[model samples]
Target: MAKEYTVTPWEVHGDVDYNEIVKEFGTKEIDDSLLKKIEKYGKLHHFLRRKHFFAHRDLDIILKDYDKGKKFYLYTGRSPSGPIHLGHMIPWMFTKWLQDTFDAPLLFQIPDEEKFLFKNNLTMEESEKWATDNILDIIALGFDHKKTSIFKNTEYAKTMYPVAVEISKRITLSKAKAVFGYTNETNIGSIFYTAMQSVPAFLPSIREGEPTNCLIPYAIDQDPHFRITRDVAPKLGYPKPASINCKFLPSLKGDSKMSSSINETCIYAGDSPEEVSSKIRKYAFSGGRDTLKEHRKKGGNPNIDVAYQWLTYFEEDDKKLEQVYHAYKSGELLSGELKEICIETINKFLSTHQKARAKAESKVEKFMLRD
Candidate 1:
């Protein structure tokens, strides 16, 4: 039997069964028909082609609206408790594709207050500091400054609070508890945080003075939060927000998603080449046989190899990736060779990213959303 897994807004554990998750979450799997429709708008992003983004809710309705010349905005967020890691960037990369393909505006929310309330050791000041640090990396992803509006919850409270109160009015305590697993011991601020999260989904509609569609591209762990947003949208006189959820990018240890709390397993945006190389070679799990001779005879299993898994996210060329996959499986490439490839690819990507990140420091104000 499969080991029991837990996936929630606060934690992820075990080897997550994605297929089982799709079933449990009641979300539709993305099929060939949907791929064709998306490819019609723009080259379907490689993440979609690779099935990294695997499921959806009300996506068809968003496409239908686009066909009818109605526009939808994109919404996604970061909770600022720590530094941003590679795993956190996966969905944002896909979100950028959605913005470009559909010519949509984006509202990038930094919910520092939520982290402050939920994290026992975190203070509001530290959360706020991390919020600024995170914004630089978000800008480094090259979101359009004119079209993208990034804001922190505390900084934008004047605008966000009124809408949150309106949304909270529509949600009952029992409903929030049932959805979020809030206990009697749970702080009241955490209970009310969901209402703040729901506000961005409808902000576009409120701003335009007419109902507008919004698309949230997020990790599947976040499905529960958006489930609440979809429920409250219409009652607040807005269109239900649509969403597409993706799987977690596994950690170097291959147990669960890459977590910032696990320093050795994560590759942060600011990590130097030396730090990245050491982490991959030292801690990345291997799928090789016990001996080199055995590996040569029976071959390595790229299926569970952490290096190969991380390669899938960075390597854009389909043919190149398949060649590496085949070579590793045939023992033509060694486990060390696979790690070298992942290391080189990531370092190359980050070398360019670090330069952009430095430039991003001066440009934060241009993209910030202000009341």
Candidate 2:
């Protein structure tokens, strides 16, 4: 029997099937018509074309508001249990594109309290440290300093708690358990954390005393949390936040999503070029035949190849990507060469990002949301 797969906000295991996940999550696929609608508002991002960001909720409605001169803000977050990995970058990269295209304000949350509640090894102090480190990475993405406001949930609790209480009133414990698979074993803080997550979606609207639409770009695993948020938005007289969901970036070992818990299977933002190359060369699961001669004869399967899959996210040029695809399928490009390409591409990205991250270290104060 095929191993059963599981996906949750706290844990992701087994290989995910995006098609099945979309159906299960009650999200609509981003179709051509919707793509055209989005293009009307802003440039169609390559992530949309490649289906990395494949599903959405109320995306059309958000655009409709934009057409009528109502603007939306961006909200997406990180749980700072550990250092961030390349997989963590996927949503933020797309978020940056959306921010630039729409010229939107962004609320970047580092939910350290959530991480502290969930991860056993992490203390509040440790989570705070990770949150600080994570903020540096977020700033490194080149978000507009003037419009971007970042806050660690614990640090800005004075501002976040009041709104979170209103959200908490609407969400029942039964609903939380059903959505998050919580049992009696779950702690009170963990249960209350969802309310904090929901606050950013409707926060700007609350502050503005008008309907400010929110667009949350995130992985599909996070859909359940926002589903609860959407449920309560109308009760509070705020518009339901719209979301664009992306598929999880595959692990180097060809398992489920790239995870911070599993160090060997993930490529971190801070990894040196040599470490990135070594990980890809040693750990990346290939879809080629065991023997080189056999691989040449039968060719490799890009569908199952980790290197090829990473390229979909990294390689933006359609023609160039197609060329690499054809070469691999025709046995003209060997596994080592493919790994080398992925390594080179990742290293190039890191070189620029690391420099930005270093600069961002000195600029963290500029992005924080104050009480």
Cα RMSD to native, each candidate?
Answer: 1.1, 1.3
lDDT, each prediction: 0.91, 0.90
* TM-score of model 2 (CA atoms): 0.97
- TM-score per candidate, chains pooled: 0.98, 0.97
**How many pairs of residues in model 2 come into backbone collision?**
0
Name the candidate that leads on TM-score: 1
Clash pairs (backbone) in predicted model 2: none
* lDDT tens digits, residue span 1-371, model 1: 65489999999998898898989888989888998888889788888998989999989999999999999999999999999889999999898888888989999999989888988999999998899999999999988898899998888999999999999999999999888898999999999999999889988888899999999999999998888988998798899998998889999999779989989999999999999999999999998778889888888999899999888899998898999999889888899999999999999988888898999989998999876
Please, what are the lDDT tens digits per residue for candidate 2 over residues 1-371?
Answer: 55378878978887687888888889899999999888875667889988899999999998888888888999999989889898999999999999998889999988888878987888998888888889989899889999899998877889889999999999999999999989999999999999999999988988899888999999988888999999999988999999999989999999879988888899999999999999999999998788889889989888899998998888888888898898898888899999999999889888899999999978888899867
Q: Give the C-alpha miss distance for residue 255 in model 1, angstroms.
A: 1.7
- What lDDT score goes with residue 228 in model 1? 90
Give the lDDT of residue 332 in candidate 1: 83
| Residue 115, candidate 2: C-alpha displacement in angstroms | 1.2
Model 2 segments more than 4 A misplaced: 1-3
